[model samples]
Target: MTDDDDLRTRLHRADPAADVPPTAPDRVSRLLEKTMTTTTAAPRRTTALRPTRLITLAAAAVVLIAALGTWFVLRPDNTPGAPVAAPTVTEITAPGIAAKCAEPTADRLTEAADLAFAGTVTTIDGRIVTLEVTNVFRGAPTDVVRVAQTGDISETMMGSGKFEVGRDYLVASSEGSMLTCGYSGEASSPGLAGLYDTAF
Candidate 1:
């Protein structure tokens, strides 16, 4: 036989055409058409948020609640229609302070003090005396001056008596407040120099 026939016989011996599935003419045409066809896909849409954003939103809510609570607890008497509390410090209401014997008069105080002035007691914070100087008859002073004292007017007593805030008084001071033995009293009283005309 010829070389072509010999090759065909060897190929048929390796694998036969009857082993392959036969394709119908209509199925072959449908497969070819589907492979060549072009189709458009619908665009995707989403409103879902990321996990980090959700956590941040929750934390902000917690902080806002905590701040509101703190303001409610710590705010000073801000509620409407509430009575205002007294601003003055509480005075020691022990039995009336005994009359200090011969509370010093003006001439004695003038002769005794290096720096004397007539001023209003703006505040007495513990042992520190804050005065609003109305008239500086002796010694250089500004409109306001602070003098140090050795005693607490509320709990303790001095020879000059307790200096009440908001009243006018004559002060006899040296380096510090040496308010003893007729050196300090009312500004308009006989205890001060300029306010009182008569000699002691």
Candidate 2:
């Protein structure tokens, strides 16, 4: 109606709620209501994965370790369960004229002939004569010679007999000079006869 009344109406119309002051209790009540609503709301579902993942990882590790152990145990050897190979026995025959002789020279022949001194007959068997030779040329022990003799003559000598362990005839010779000596009658270029010549 008047100027002052019009100013007052304009101010009230501009902000009617500005005249009202907010109380502390009203602000606190709003905050409490907001907190209650937030707390009551359904919580987002969280994945229960860490425990399961750890279990799965542990299982995989166990499986890997077990597989490796099994593989190692089952590994095969190059020659599995085979008997140990025996040493190769190489039969080395003696060398010289004894090898050229048709008849096999006895071991005794080498013992009897290899020495400078003559040997005595220790034992005589059919086609086999054992002699004990002394005064060995090369400090060789008294070796026994087993000669092969028949028809008033000695045949090819074979080898020396082992009359006693560690004791042998100094030399052995085959009669008729057809003596062949060797580990197993193996022939050599310079045979036992050559060896005899060198020794005597």
Candidate that scores best on lDDT: 1
Steric collisions counted per model: 5, 38
- Alpha-carbon shift of residue 130 in model 2 (angstroms): 1.1
Indicate the worst ten consecutive residues by lDDT in candidate 2. Answer: 41-50
lDDT of 2 by residue, 1-200 (tens): 69999999898889968878777898889997666433322111111112232233233333423343342233221223422232111111222332343432433434544323223343445545444322233323332334444333212332332222222222332222322333121111124334443434
The parts of candidate 2 lying over 4 Å away from their true place are 1-117, 148-199
lDDT of 2 at 83: 22
Please estimate how well model 1 matches the true structure, expressed as its whole-model Cα lDDT.
Answer: 0.44
lDDT by residue (tens digit), candidate 1, 47-123: 00122222332343244234433422332321233222322121111122234546545556556556655545666
Query: Top model by TM-score, which number?
Result: 1
* TM-score of each model, in listed order: 0.38, 0.21
TM-score of 2: 0.21
Error of 1 at 164 (Å): 1.6
